[model samples]
Target chain A: MAPPKRSVPDSSANGGALSLPRQAGDQRRDPSDRAIAEACGRGEAWAMELIYHRYRRRVYGLASRIAGPEDADEVAQEAFVRILRGLPKFRGDAQLGTWIYRLAVNAALTHVTRRPRHTEGDEVLDNIPAAQTSARDPGLSARLERALVALPAGYRAVLVLHDIEGLSHEECATILECRVGTSKSQLHKARARMRELLGPALAAERKGE
Target chain B: MRCPQLQRLSSRFLDGDLGAERASAARGHLRDCERCQRAVAAEAEIVAAARSLPSSPEPAQGWDVLWGRVSARVAEEERADAARSAASLWWRENRSRLTLAVSAGAAFAFVLWGAPALPALGPGPLGLVPGSSSGGDQAVTEGGPERDGVGESLAERGARERAETDRQFREAVSELEVIIAEEQAFSDGARADAAGAELGAIRERVRGAKAARVALPDTAGRPSPRQDPVYEAYWEELATLQRAAVGVSDGEPGAGFRQDPAGRAPATGPVTGDDRGGDGPQGPGGARDSAGDGEGTR
Candidate 1:
């Protein structure tokens, strides 16, 4: 058989060589959030693209953490669409990134909460890395992950933002809409509990070694 | 900073929130006390472990899928906007033309309705006989020589009437001037009366001052003339009063004539050629003749 040729459209061929460096430089010189927001307010395509590029990763990360991998993609896209619609009313006191992260987290949380109980899939420990998983420990990582998932949504959110995400206490508090004192206390309690849950397994592993 | 306080400060301290003095106190306590130091260390370790947890992986499908959705939405919005703008531009361009067409149609209808009604209202300038029309046309044709006999007669009559009117107007003006002059005299008399009254009061005051001066014996004591400020002030006031009285009297006559107290100028004896006849004389005897003429004219 002859080698299959890659099909390319004429328009795409013509447009493929266009670079964004000059456009990016122009935008960088006038990197006004207000201008981007105003354009987004008018529903401009390029403005929406800029907004998505700026915040999509953080939004997707937050959504994946809250809703798990299955629904994370839908949750993140929905969050961006909501952000675009709400851009006109976005008061500028908080950083745009922080606002976007909060929206994504809320949307993911809401989605997960509204899902049917039976829809939660089997607890699987197969994906655990070899370094984290031992032959002797049947499902230690799985149990820890279960304990973390079992934490109340509020505590889980704060813990993830403060601990797993490595955000500052103030940043966690801003995203969770809680006081800094509450964030610190909640983080301390969550870690102590996680340690308590994991302590026996970890100790058993050491003893066996 | 031990126990409960230490517990509170432990959280703040770990979060880097303790005030300087309190933090220093906590630091000192932690250094000395092993129990609190261990607690702090344990908290730090836990926080570190929590922070060390790996973040969730990125979604398997890349941004290409999201970009596709966004591009579709953007294209739809752009098309809608373009359609709106095109419609608006079309309306703006054609609005004046539409208004002009409507206005012309309305004006033509109005003229069609109005044209027949024009003749029924009354005869216009074109309908009347030239010499036999009413007073308006007669007035207009008065100077034409086609009606030369009538025109010459009318001209003679108008000139005679105008001369008569001029004579009457002159007579009226002369009578008014005489009335004005008499009024001025009356006002002057009234002002003189008021001045006399003021003069009497001043004389009485002067007489009292003289009496006081006379009663003081010259031999008793005499203050230096320059030191008598009261006497000097009184003398100056008297001089001021006299000057004011003279000014008041002078201004009164002109104001009275301008005000015209009788309200109308008097008529004269048939207004003879002499302009001064209307004035009669500059005395009270002329008042009778002037007053009679006023009554007769009315």
Candidate 2:
């Protein structure tokens, strides 16, 4: 019995539109992120899981890039936990999807910071949950994941949001709670770190290609 | 442009964040600098490869089953919320009485922490007589502890120590209750686990719960010998064990470990069985102290 209403979402604050869950069927066209968020606030079960379904991959993607696959599912769960707990009181100042992205990024960053010695390889890969392969170049993808995990949490979050998730610097700053200039600086440093980590892997992938 | 200058704009160029003029200049420089070109190309590849990695879907086997976990968790959260609401309602209904009680409590706290500082309010400043200035020492010593053979100062000191122990005991018991409740919950979860890695995680959690219980000082129903954080943690663990039991079973839950129905635990589970109890919680205090000590070591 959530009262759905029309409220314009301010995309400029969060940089752009993210794929938020829309109402299904005949109700799809009119349901904005704000409407779905409002419905969620009103205690609609569909709205809650819809939030989960829509952001699952994006959340998993951000977490996998930053926290590695072994820890990504946990991070994603923590993110949803926060979102479910926080969505009830959500005031629509920003896009709902942006808020979710911010939660996921922050969760991923905290997980990375908590476990600094997260070793990579076959054993760690064994614990990773079910992942479907969309990767055209699995060799390059593996190398990039390794390199990404090597960056600092702050820098990794920014790089994931901007470079991997294809968010703008403004968007990265919005999610990371830093200035645009800081996001750009961190992105610069993260790229350098990636180059250092991926040098041999990059060459190997290229040679294999 | 110098390589350093071009390098600074590298992210901007990759993100297309630079102004059109600066982007044009960076492109011209990139045409001459092979190193910068390679850097740009690598950045692009990283982004593209990252995007292409398979999305980690919700595990089909785990999703339907874990959804049960989620529902259980959500229901637990709702129960907590309901409890909070009940507390809130109690506060609202009893606000006037609560205000009076709180005012009295503040006065009581003032009497505890402030009494020593105020000459007019509490224990003597070691100099003053209640009435006469000239006969101060005589009057101060007058009518003090003529029968008990213990001075009023010593009696007061003993009373303070007893109160402190009583307070510590309450804290320790509250903490132990939480721990026990959580242990029961963990056991229920372990029983429900399917084999493979999930079972491994449940076993790890069980080990962790055991480690938490090990933090207890083997005081074993001995009335909290000291107010230690370790004791507090174990008490909380017990309380959690109880809550977990209530969630899992209807027949004889936390009664398995904690013998006290009133929950007054200077208590223990049998030394051999982590989840079973005999006379441990109700046994002679000193005997359980020795027995609980042995179990604590394991």
Candidate 3:
């Protein structure tokens, strides 16, 4: 059997209290993110907690786009484990959030490929509030999620990193291990296909706005 | 203006990546090209929708669970690395002793099966008996006697025959002395015949040393030129005469004599100097005769 997926915690419950202590330096600091990376590298407990709290939502969102809502939690957890193991070797050449997001995308893809028939309903989409579903058009978010899931793993990874996460083409290239030209090409293709999938809803939303 | 070129630029343009010239050309082409313009708008909407999609809600499990899994993996990898390092250290420490044991085993095998066969040395042909010497009475007794007792009696007979053997040995010695005296007179004639051979060899050696010394180009000091061959030959002759006088002085009576048998009386005879006449010390005429005939070749 494939290894069990990791279970990442909900970031909303811990709020911003789980962030790392601020360092007095000239650099623009994400004290929480920096603390998590250093703690994970040193195998410290609080650092790991901060890392999980900081990246859990972003990692799960990436995993959900790639693998679906069902396996996203496990994929997110495994991505954190991988990050912890790779932390010492991480040279901080890229943003920690970008690196962790890439790891989450890869973990989700691996989970999907290993069990291709597994569906999104296998695991509940944890921490999705019932009120937000009615207040916002939860159906649009669901439709967008389904459209992304319908795309190929490579296309989905590019779309999620370049579009939803707002990563630049170069940053997407670093995560995908491709040239910027390739990243842009993949992003264009992924967006074109996604529009084809959600054409009616996008048209309706545009008309309503 | 071309459809294929327009379509290719459409992808880059939607991504906002078409360079200024290409983007302007693409926009100009799309303005005139309705079919291409529709495709460009559709691509733009897709990129916009993808960018605006809502992020997923966070998972229910919190940081504690995720941290636990990460810590476990890190710990496992560290343990594996430590084990590998320990194994490598063990190998490094034991390698020298292992090599020494292998070398010793190889040497032992060489001695056991790879050694060359040795030649046998028993009491047979070419066998050597320890302590055997000439003129010793115990020589025959020391070597094992034949089982028939014939070897024992033969050894006794050999011992009794020694007295008669002593008389014959003295006569042989006297005859050898006479022959030696005649040979000496012949040698004297040959010495006179070949008047300057010894002196010539000496002169050649001196000339060789002088030339070698000159060829070396003395770094210490300049050397005098070598003497002419005639002058060198004269000095060599004088040296030969001096050597002969020394030889005569060393060869006094009883200087070359060996011991005779105990019971033998002293034997005397006339000294025959007749064989030395043709090359006598009288003049150079006899020397020329000896040289022409090659009679006293030295």
Error of 1 at B279 (Å): 99
lDDT of 3 by residue, B1-298 (tens): 5778877666667656678888888878987988777666656655555555766656666556655665676577567545432222222222223222322322222221111122334333323233322112233325553111333332233233332332332333233334334434565544323323433444454565445423432211312112222222222322332222112111332112111122111111000011111111111001111111101111
Interface root-mean-square deviation, candidate 1: 38.9
Per-residue CA lDDT of model 2 for A76-194, tens digit only, reads 76666667656654566656766777777666665564564665444333333222333245555655666555555666777667666666666666666667788788878877777
Chain B vs. true chain B: TM-score per candidate = 0.22, 0.29, 0.27
Question: Listing candidates in order, what is each one's chain A TM-score?
Answer: 0.71, 0.73, 0.70
The candidate that achieves the highest DockQ relative to the unseen native structure: 2
> Mind sharing the TM-score for model 3?
0.45
Q: Per-residue lDDT tens digits of candidate 3, residues A3-84? A: 1222232222243456545557722133444545565666665566566666666776887777777776677766766666
Q: What is the number of residue pairs that collide in model 2?
A: 29
Clashes of each: 0, 29, 4
lDDT of 2 at B146: 13
Clashes of 3: 4
The DockQ-based order of candidates, best leading, equals 2, 3, 1
Docking level of model 2: incorrect
Which regions in candidate 3 have their CA more than 4 angstroms from the true location? A1-15, A19-38, A117-141, A199-209, B61-298
Give the clashing residue pairs of candidate 3, or none. A9-B61, A9-B62, A10-B61, A20-A32
For each candidate, what's the DockQ?
A: 0.07, 0.16, 0.13
DockQ, candidate 3, vs. native dimer:
0.13
lDDT sort, best first: 2, 3, 1
